[model samples]
Target: MANTHEMTVPVTRPTAARQPHPSGRRLTAHLASVADDLTALWQRLEDDPAVAFHQGRAWVEAWREATGANLCLVTLEQDGAAVAMLPLEIKRSCGLSIARFAGTAFSNENTGLLDSVRLADLAPVTADELALTLSQAGLGADVVLFDKLTPATAADAPYSALPKVFHQNPSFQLPLFADFSAVLAQINGKRRRKKMRVSERRLEAMGGYRHLIGEDDALALRLLETFFRQKALRFAAQGLPDVFADPAVRTFLRILATDRDANGRAALELHGLELAGGDHEGEIIAVSGLTLKHGHVTCQFGSINDVIAADVSAGELLFYRMIERAALAGHKLFDFGVGDQSYKRSWCPQRTELVDCYVPLNLKGRLAAPLIAGMIRLKRVIKTSPGLHRLATWLRGLPVRRQKAAAEPD
Candidate 1:
């Protein structure tokens, strides 16, 4: 297959002089080839506190590690002062290239980190000039995946008209309450009270519900392993092969953790809820690994140990706590990241759509894009279809018992 990636050039307006004008004050895209510039810019920017990768000295270092194909950075400068910055990474595999955000698939959402205050004050001339400058920059990518964008920033983005640029639905955001009482009120007053009642009774009858946010260095790695094991087995049992079962996928996460850790000097957060009591002591029921990006917190990867704690509501409690911590930390958003789940809806009334928009750059690739999209849509339909899904599960040698066994350590 040829390198079949789509490229989007910001739509431009023809100048009165009959020239196409770039939308923003000629924004400049520069390769963060200089460590000093990147480090300085990252530190000065009001980045999301939850994400360590985009802050301080480490962000520059991460760029060095993942320097494969050059997608470079778009630096919007106003009179020599850096105003807006977008870090982009381009990856090539299987003879195809795609431009996603730097560390995106793993990142909950990445922002262009433009100065809304400055942008808001700009005249049409300034906006066009900036856009033209960025447009002229020698940035090349087959496809641009502008991951999860905050509503505020996305609203002001100059490149919104770029092909395939669309806002995903409002992502799920959980309101962090000041106290447990506030949290329970949001979950359906009566239902929340009942659940809490049940939880208290269970705890009194047993020992207590244990919540752990592993602070150990090895906790993140271990939790990630468990999550993958559970997720893979679950998918396999459902008659679907785990897409992330590939080593490269695993390697990417490991590398991501290591790289981000080295940069931020902080380990990933791994939250676990366990059933602790009686003969079955310390059985893990739910686990989640979340990534912090500046002031934005996102639930990255996680799994629930539903077997032993089916009655305990460990997962719900854990998530509830996560929101509390996020709110306490003053995080603006707590992204459930991607996916639609019943629990997510309970906590968040808002949701954003994640779309894979395509603009075929080449004739052959263009023709194939629609077909590929249809195929993807079809796969989703089949996977979600109840009866066929069960059949597929059976064919995949799926059994709950076997799944549990496979998940256990030797």
Candidate 2:
């Protein structure tokens, strides 16, 4: 059911955290790459309301295709029947092998073990047993880190028992009403309408603009590239890191945007605003990638080209266009994904908190965990403290000048 393609890599490192009985009769765990055996369970778990789009079949397949990351399917069995599963990617962090959920990054709002409820209900020894099992299974990871975990996962057992930190930035959400007018009321309706009209007039006077949903694969890929460029420019302007810098990530976006499920719904959909004809003819000013699932619309990524029309507020206008569509289509929730930007807050009155769960499997992990946590916490501090954030932003913007000055040599 997952359309799986994964290869289990051999564990070469010494098992530093193995248990005396890694495979106890009552609780045995095995590792594999293929998920075909767990298709039924995957389907059942996916049907659960807590399962987000990131873990859906199509999204997983697209990710695998894009990066071809090493996969580890850890299945736990109780009395010969499967009871829990963990889908992990074996990655190298520092000198340690790190195990993380495949879709940990890229600002997705969810990641959790497939058997959250069951895993939590497992015996008290399950946590230690799991660590030993992971070591024996050859995942070769010193620790397991599941970031951006939903509330359900955070409230559950083994994970809940482990160290966790709340996400620095929670996801912002806008609740949709029966109509666009009603939805606009959540924010200042009249002000928004006037702003929209102003934006439309500016764009209309410049030439003409059109809202588009990229249904065709070719067009979608083109808009995705535009998004990349705009985002890079935006990040550079803001002196922020560009997370979409990876080539594999671009391929990943392309695959997801083009892939449609049996119901003809795509796991990722691309939408944009394009200038029909003007000085910058056929240029896309704004782009938004979204996923529509269970009547919810979550924006995965978005960008705007202010170089064309700064006064037009193309990004906000594009959001208005997208949210209006979601409202008209009867989508209940419009999620701005993970971040707390002023624009997102201006429209969203709801927020979803995320948790980062960390578990140290061995001595190496025990030593490294604190350093990692410290860095995360430090980042959070910097983000929350306006003075520190401004200072950091200034430093980021100075790297280029610093390099140039250093090169000038005495």
Candidate 3:
């Protein structure tokens, strides 16, 4: 069984005196002084349909434990009732104080918590007011960087009202059907079917294989560790920086994988492919980590023992099985997340556009904004062009050479 952390917070205003806005709607923003304060606001936000698992209390708590950053919760109030909340983290990045959405390293999608009824009637000016208030909330941040936001999320009054730079990062999603066959029928062309059949045959020759869904926290943690090791190998082979190499990131993932939600389901689900008999018999050859919420199953990361299961395409096979499992479990959508991979396109027909918002809080932030925007634009260009991307990968793969030290004069 996974560990459960029940969050409980008392609803109260900040200790500092709050002045009424000119429009008569009191806007009070403060750093959540304690975990309980955040828990209370998070519980209230849970009632709103717009809040995703990424912005939930559990996810934020995991992130806080992994990265010890200051938590700032900004709330907008009307008639002494909170209408919206923005959960942010303040940290120093690139020599400047910055505020960013919490859990950016692991969250696939993010949005602010908004009161549904109020959101429906929110005016453009009011949205702008909320954004302005957050910028000047005295969080000691020079700028705000909001990333991985979809249009539906950004449409929330506060985000929509902000004057900021935008960048496009597209994500993919597949609308699932009642059965696996129905889902397969839509994407399983002759070539794909042939490949899948070949993979199945190859795996069968290797003494059979089984797809295993972890049922306990211990098993889940073990599988997660295997995934991290496999991912590290993959990253090294491809000359890419291993984000999971950081111990903090691993700790955060473990917390997520071992935490249970209200329904007794682990917040992070782990699945693996195990060989029944072979040189690597009883070992998990491939693994996938995912999260299920709001009728959607989002694939977070996956890894395979390419050296041992390359012929069978274990990673893809595992995904096929997971998709079937998700459909059988009544998930309405399978999201591949934000990436432009040929494999993702083969499965997900729907594309969601994401945007990044950069808000300058002071004169220093204004001066640094363009540099940051330019870097993002350059990365987008490199990621989109096949030749450039390949070249970049090759360059990254080249080992760094150290120059010989000069000999001392005789």
Q: For each candidate, what TM-score against the reference?
A: 0.70, 0.84, 0.86
Q: Is candidate 1 or candidate 2 better by lDDT?
A: 2
lDDT of 1 by residue, 1-410 (tens): 01112222332322333233355444354555454556666656645342234322343345435544253666766545666666666666445454556655555445555566665654333333433454456445433445555433334444433323333223465545445455545556567557656765765466666677656547656666767877786675565667668675665555545543544534357777655786566766678876666556768767776466567676666776677777776665566865545667776645554333333333443445445456545655656577875676576654545776788999
Model 3 Cα lDDT, one tens digit per residue, 1-410: 11112212221111232233456545555555456766766687865656767877777878888877587776766555677776788888789988877887677787767787875554443433443566666667777777777766665555655433334346778778777777776675455567778888888888889888777898899899999999988886665777898898899899989899676688889999989887878888999988877777889888999788777888888888888888888889998887778778777767776766666677788788778777777877888788988987777655411111223344
Give me the overall lDDT of model 3.
0.73
* Tens-place lDDT digits, model 2, residues 1-410: 01112212221222244334334445666787877876887777777666677766667667777999887777766656666567778798778877887766774666443555665546543345666656776666888887777665665544544567766667777889777888887778898889999999999988989898887778888889899999998876675667798889888888898897676655688889999778976889999999876777889888998688878998888999999988988889998888767787788767666777677789998899878777777877888789998898788778755655678869
Could you say which candidate leads in TM-score? 3
Which one is best on lDDT? 2
TM-score of 3: 0.86
Q: List candidate 2 stretches off by more than 4 Å.
A: 1-28, 113-126, 239-241, 397-410
After superposition, candidate 3 runs with Cα above 4 Å error: 1-27, 126-128, 164-168, 189-194, 394-410
- How do these models rank on TM-score, best leading? 3, 2, 1
